[model samples]
Target: MANTMWRRGVEWLAAAAADPRACKWEWDHGEGIALLEAGRFWDVLTVPDRLGLLALDLLWRPGLPVPGPTLVDTAAGRVGFFLPPDPSGGWVGSGLRYAAKGSWVAVPPPYRSARFLEWLIPPDGNGVLHPPGPLEKALREAHGALAVLAPMCGR
Candidate 1:
């Protein structure tokens, strides 16, 4: 049930990505891995920015209302549309994770899910975006990447 809701949210975000106003954020190396290592992954992106590459980290907290659809550019791809917290701030947890060929060679499981959301492309010559695929493939890839890198990471 929760996963279904999450997927719906992602779809909504993808539609929003069609907006011409949306732009790419920025990417910081190792940030996604760091989020995975830390349980507090929501710090990466929030619930409104845009669907693109974001370079900076946004702030969020329990009971703190956010204007999100928080989009950002990560090393892996354009990752965003974070999960918002419940009304009580319970489940405020979120992680817009990103992974690339080498840097993401080894990431722990805890950060697999929400950390990575969507892979996007510039569908038109306009600034609008075309986000592709579900988080499942990316999660699976991360899982696979970790398996290949884990032996070297000594875990």
Candidate 2:
């Protein structure tokens, strides 16, 4: 059952690529990572690791809805959150970068972590995504938390 779910998840993720079959083939053939186009199935909102981690914690707390797929680029110190495509530019500010329309995100296979890329929250193959309302709230809370801590750390 787990394997089937994972396969479905992989398939779902690959659908974001320009060529789904080729993308899946790359993953199956031991490719560490592949760049998948954004703004199709979903868009990506990227933030600094510190801020993103804090928001992730808040989002996953008891009774809150689980967030969609999240990716971390360790080498780049950034985290990407998958959200429904919002072409009206609603995802600007708070040091967040919106990857919509023409952007691409590096994705590793759902079952494994690539060298500098890892899944902070992996997709479940059910096509769920992070809703904008709660996501913005979580990010604001995270920002406030960091603001409080920054002074103590002299940062």
lDDT of 1 by residue, 15-123 (tens): 3332212211111223322222111222122222222222112123233333233333443454443332222333222343432212212121111222543233211
Candidate 1 local Cα displacement, residue 125, angstroms: 8.7
Q: Each candidate's TM vs. the true structure?
A: 0.22, 0.94
In angstroms, the error of model 2 at 142 is 0.5
Evaluate model 1: give its TM-score.
Answer: 0.22
Model 2 residue 41 CA deviation (Å) reads: 0.6
What are the per-residue Cα lDDT tens digits for candidate 2 across 1-155?
87987888898899898888888887778666889988888999999999999999899888878888899999999989999988875877867899998988889988889889999888889999998888899999999999999999999
Which one is best on TM-score? 2
- Give all candidates' CA lDDT scores: 0.30, 0.88
Report RMSD (Å) for each prediction in the order shown: 16.6, 1.2
Q: Which regions of candidate 1 deviate over 4 angstroms?
A: 1-78, 81-120, 125-134, 153-155
Which stretch of 10 consecutive residues in model 2 shows the poorest summed lDDT? 86-95
